[model samples]
Target: MTDAIRVTGLTKRFGARTVVDAVDLRVPEGRIMGFLGPNGSGKTTTIRMLCGLLTVDGGEGTVLGLDIRTAAAAIKRQAGYMTQRFSLYEDMTVGENLDFAARVQSVPGRRARVAEALDRMGLGGRRDQLAGHLSGGWKQRLALAATILHKPRLLLLDEPTAGVDPQARREFWDRIHGFAAEGMTVLVSTHYMDEAERCHAIAYIAYGKLLAAGSVAEVTAAAGLAAADVSGGDPELVRRIKALPSVETATAMGAQVHVAGADAAALAADLDRLAAEGLSWRPAPANLEDVFIHLMARRPDPAEAAR
Candidate 1:
């Protein structure tokens, strides 16, 4: 599969601070690539560079078969970007917002395009309602409709479902999948592990660096982490287990306690002792959350490093 986005040593600097250090990324055509990282980890910066919304201070890449450095204007015209926050005018009605977007994008048949977008997003009934009056979910839909008003081949979504409800998030993802099915490339930044798993592949960045990039199963397997879920363990037992030298993470999942570690042999020895205290455990597979947390721990924050 051809890479819809391919960059090598992609770098972005803000003044003296290198917000996006030398990083490389590749997203296959027509696939959703999840951008995962903690806040201020340069995910937004990397994405902006990919779509040519921001200038590349240093690096080389191609987006949509055009050079990123010189073809930014053309890239912007073809790519759709939805910011993390709702950016449409609140005073405008849904229909007005979409219509205005159509005009801004210079879309042909503005009226027809706006009507189609309204129906596509299921906002036909609320087209006349003020954008501010819509719920979070509806607001999300309006943003997406406006983003794709001109039918962009590349979609860059920055935490698009941050505060939306579960059902709404699911519905939004369904639409995303639909677009991908039709050969639209998507790169989305999200904090939700479930959302990351839905993507065809994921890239994890931290402290201006790209640490992990692969399919969910591949990334999870690369971490070399082991875990065990324990039942019949009290909250105090969880606390005691977490204090063990070999334990990396000990989290409670309702009635069960999940623990993971890098030193599997040591961890097993520790757990075996705890099992005598009425705790029952079976080796559990390492999951995305476990891998995500491990990656986060692997990188030290730049601020912390300076201090």
Candidate 2:
């Protein structure tokens, strides 16, 4: 498959600090690549560089077949970026906001395009509503409408559903899937594990380094964590399990506890203790959240290491 975005040794530093290390990434055309990482792990910086909003301190690659180093402006023209925060003129009406975006992007047939975008995003009925007066869900719709006002080839969504209600979030994802079906390459950053699972592929980063990539199954398999679901709701039991030297994580989920660790033999011994205490737990498969937690715990903070 042809790649819509491919880059190698992508690095960015702020003064003496390296925010993004020598990272290599490939996003295939017409695919949804979920960018998963903790805050301050260079996800935003990397996205900015890809779309030409920020200069690349180091890297060489292409976005939509244009040279990233020299064709930044050209790249920006065809790429739509939606920031984490709602960024639109609150004082302006929904229709007015979209019209301004079309004008700024120099979109052709501005009137028709803006009208089409408004309808597509289900904002046609609310076109005259002041942006600031809209609820969180409506605001999200408006932002998305503006992002696609110019019909960009690549969509970069950075935590787009952070504060959206569950129903609105689902509808937004439906639209995203529709765009991907029409062959638009999408690279979205999200903290929600369920959203990440919806993506065609995943790229996980921590401490400025990529720790995992590939499908959900592949990443969880590579993590190689031994996990179990122990049945118990007692807080004291959970606390004791957490204090176990070999147990990496013991989280209470409703009436049960999900536990995991890297060392099989040692962790099994801890489980045996819980079994003797009349708690029942069976071996379970490791999941995406478990893998990410394991990854973060294993990676030391660079700032802490420097000191």
Candidate 3:
């Protein structure tokens, strides 16, 4: 597939502080790339730069084949952005909000487009419902409908499913995958691990830095971490595992203690000793969340680095 987004050394600064440091990213056409990071970690800043909502303080790139620096207007025209918060007119009905969005974008065949968007989002029956009265799920669907009313080729979603229910988040992801199948590229920032796993690929940023980017399996494998799930372990045993030099992290997931480490042999040896003490241990694959947590822990605080 052709590249839909290709940028290198992308940087954005505010006064002396750089919110988004030199970063590189690429997303193939018709693919969904999850952007993962802690709050204030430059994920939103990078998204703004990608869609031309903010000017790049340094570096260069092309979004939807348009120069991010020189053709921001063109990029903006072809990109649909959904913010974390709902930004539609609360007083308007669902249909009205979509209609207004289409008009604002100067979309042709406004009525047909609005109807299509409504039906596509399963909001045709709720077209007359007031935006302010809709539940979080319905409101999200309406926002998504408004976003796609313009038929943008590139979609930039920033924490789009934050407050929605699990089922709503699932439905939202299904819609996102449908869009990618239709050849629309998507870049979405999210904090949910399940949502991150839904993407074709993921990019993790922290403290203004792009730390990792790859498929879930690829990222986890690249961490070179080994893990084990231990059952029937007492709380004190869990603490001992956490304090081990070979263990990078030991998290309790229900009845099992999920432990991970960079030194596979040493970690296995430690687990073996624990197993001798009565814990039932089984090898486990390191998950994306584990790798991400390890990455975050390894990186120093931005303020400390500055000092």
Candidate 4:
């Protein structure tokens, strides 16, 4: 089957810095692929390149089965891209903004489309409100409505839920899942691990490189991480474990400390040594956040390593 988005050897550079290195990805149709990374890690750059917003300095790819390099305009028309910032006119009313967007896209039955967009996002009652006065949640709803107004085959969301309230974020994700259930493909970039877990699959990019890509369980297991949850009397047992050569990360949570390492046996030995200290320890499943932190810390810096 033809993939919804496929790219090979993708690379982008800005002057002296290579923001996105050669990367390969394949996202099937009707699936939500989560793109995750830290700040300035080229997540946005990669998204732009795939969606035909920015030209790739090198590499070849197809989005929605159209040539990314040569048929950018064509591909762009079939994709919905929600930028990091709200882009609609603040002076316009909610209804006015949707109407204008429909007109610009040349969507058939402009008024009907605008009304549907407003209604679909549960903004029909607030249609008369000025775009500028809406809170972050309402603005996010408006952005999402505008993005889907064009009925594109794929949706690319760049930090779509940032700064929104928890309730609003939940509602937004529910709508996203509804879209995916209807066979609409989505590629969302987010910093929240909880949101990342909601995706069908995830790709972690750091410093322009693809660090890990797989299901939540697969990614964590592939990281070769073993975590032991410790609780009880002495908390200093965790501190002692931290000094072991095998422990890669030791983090506290409430009354428990999670000691993780790539070598399970060595980590177990370290914890065993602390068994007599009245500290209780049990092996725990490695969470996505733990694996993400481990990958980030283990990533080698070429400049520093060269020395």
Candidate 5:
């Protein structure tokens, strides 16, 4: 089967500034593809280009089997996009907004579609409430309802869980899984590591570059970071270990110092020596956040992208 989304050498620029640089990506059908990057890393720009909301400056890709350059309108029609900000009318009631969306999408049985959306999002009882008066979580629910009202094949979510409470984020992810189980493909961009872990595949972009792409385990393994958990804050211990030639990252976390380096044996030996200095140590799995931060620090500053 054809991938849900496929692109190669995708690049977007504004004037002399390149926002998305020569990125390649593929998302298999019936899977959640997580897009991860720091702010201004061109994640949103790339997603927009894929969904055909914005034309690409230089690149070629197919979304939902449609040529991105020539069939953008068709791709847009087949995709449901939930942007980072709330774009619905605040003056309208919850049900009214959904009704407006269904009508705009020209969905058959518009009234029934609106009702279903309200129920699906658990906003049925608050249907008559003004959207402006709702909390961040409720507004998110409404936005989701509106976006999926047309039953699009592909869902593009840009930081959909931002500013939402933990419980609300959980509920939102549950809904996404439900959609994916039903054979719908989803591409979500998020800053949260938990959210990224929920995806079947993750792509990490930095400075408009595609840094890593794979299952969680695959990416972490590829990072080649050796980590040691050290308890008790010792300025001398940190300084001593950091001074070692092989140690790449030695930083404190709460009462513990997570020391990581490319050489497992070297990091281990350093920790063992620290134990002689009254420090407690244990082997720990290298965290994804650590790997990515290390990756970012190694990249050229994004400010240079505009040059």
Candidate 6:
């Protein structure tokens, strides 16, 4: 498949601080690529640059085949952007808000387009409801409806499911998949691991750098980390496991401790010794969260590194 977005040496700076540093990214047409990163890690900055919402300090790329540097207006016209907040006017009714959006985008057949957005987003019955009166889920649905009112080919969603309940988030993702099935390309930034796993692939960013990118299995495997699940009643065991030279991270989840390390042989040896202490040791597949934490730990703080 062809790439909807292809960029290299994408860099952004604020004053003396480089917020996004020499990042390279590609999103294939008709695919969903999750943008994962911790707070202040430049995920938002990168998304803005991709959609042409923000100017790039250094980079060369195309979004939807339009030059990112020179064709920002054209790029913005074809791309749908949903900000982290509910950007629609709250006092306006659902239908009114969509109508306003349609008008703002200068959508042809504005009335019909607004109606279609309402029906498509399942907000038809609630069209008369005030935007402020809607719940978090409904607000999200409304935001999405407004976003697609202009029929953008590419969607840039920034933390689209933040603060939403699980069921609502699931429904939102279902709609997103429906859009992708219809050939819409999506690049969504999110912090939820479950949401990250739902994407066709994920790009992990840290300290303004692109650390990892690939399918879930590929990224995890590329981390070169081995993990083991230990179940025991002894809390002291968890502490000891964390201090081991072989273990990179030890996380306690209920009665089991999930330990991981980059060196498989060394981690296995450490587990073997711990197993002698009557703890149950079982090999566990490395998860996305584990790989992310490991990557974050390995990278230095961008500020400190700059100094």
lDDT of 6 by residue, 1-307 (tens): 8899999999999998899999999999999999999999999999899888789999899999999999999998899999998999999999999998898888999999998889998999999999999999899999999999999999999999999999999999999999999999999999998888889999999989999999988999899899999998587878999999999889999999998989999999988888787878899998888899899889978667869
TM-score of every prediction relative to native = 0.97, 0.97, 0.96, 0.94, 0.94, 0.97
Q: Per-residue alpha-carbon lDDT of model 3 for 1-307, expressed as tens digits?
A: 6888999999999999999999999999999999999899999899999888889999998999899999998988899999888999999999889988999899999999999999899999999989999999999999999999888999999999999999999989999999999999999999999999999999999999999999998899999889999899566767888988899888988888999988999998988887788878889999887898889889988798878
Off by over 4 Å in 1: none
Clashing pairs in 6: none
Better of 1 and 2 by lDDT: 1
**Model 6 scores what on Cα lDDT?**
0.92
Count of steric clashes across candidates, in order: 0, 0, 0, 0, 0, 0
lDDT of 3 at 103: 91
Residue-level lDDT of model 2, residues 1-307, one tens digit each, is 8899999888898998888887788999999999999999999988988998888889788999988889998998999999888899999999999999999999999999999999898898999999999998999899988998888889999899998999999999999999999999999999999999999999999878888999888999999999988896477778888998877888888888888999888888888887887888888988889899999999988888879
Candidate 2 residues lying further than 4 Å off, grouped into runs, are none
Report the number of the highest-lDDT candidate.
Answer: 6
Measured by TM-score, how close is model 1 to the native structure?
0.97
Q: What is candidate 1's lDDT per residue for 1-307, written digit by digit as tens?
A: 8988999999999999999998998988899999999999999999888887789999898988889999988888888999888999999999999998999889999999999999999999999999999999999999999999999989999999999999999999999999999999999999999999999999999888999999999999999999999888566878898899888888989989888988899989999998888788899998888887888777778789899
lDDT per model, in order? 0.92, 0.90, 0.91, 0.88, 0.89, 0.92
lDDT of 4 by residue, 1-307 (tens): 5588889889998987888998888888888899998888889999999888788998898899888899988877789899998989999999988888777777898888888889899999999999999999999999999999988889999999999999999999999999988878999999998999999899999888889998887898899898988887555656776788878888888788887888899889878877776778999988888888888887765445769
What lDDT is obtained when candidate 3 is compared to the true structure?
0.91
Global lDDT of model 5: 0.89
Considering only N, C-alpha and C atoms within 3 Å, which residue pairs clash in candidate 1? none
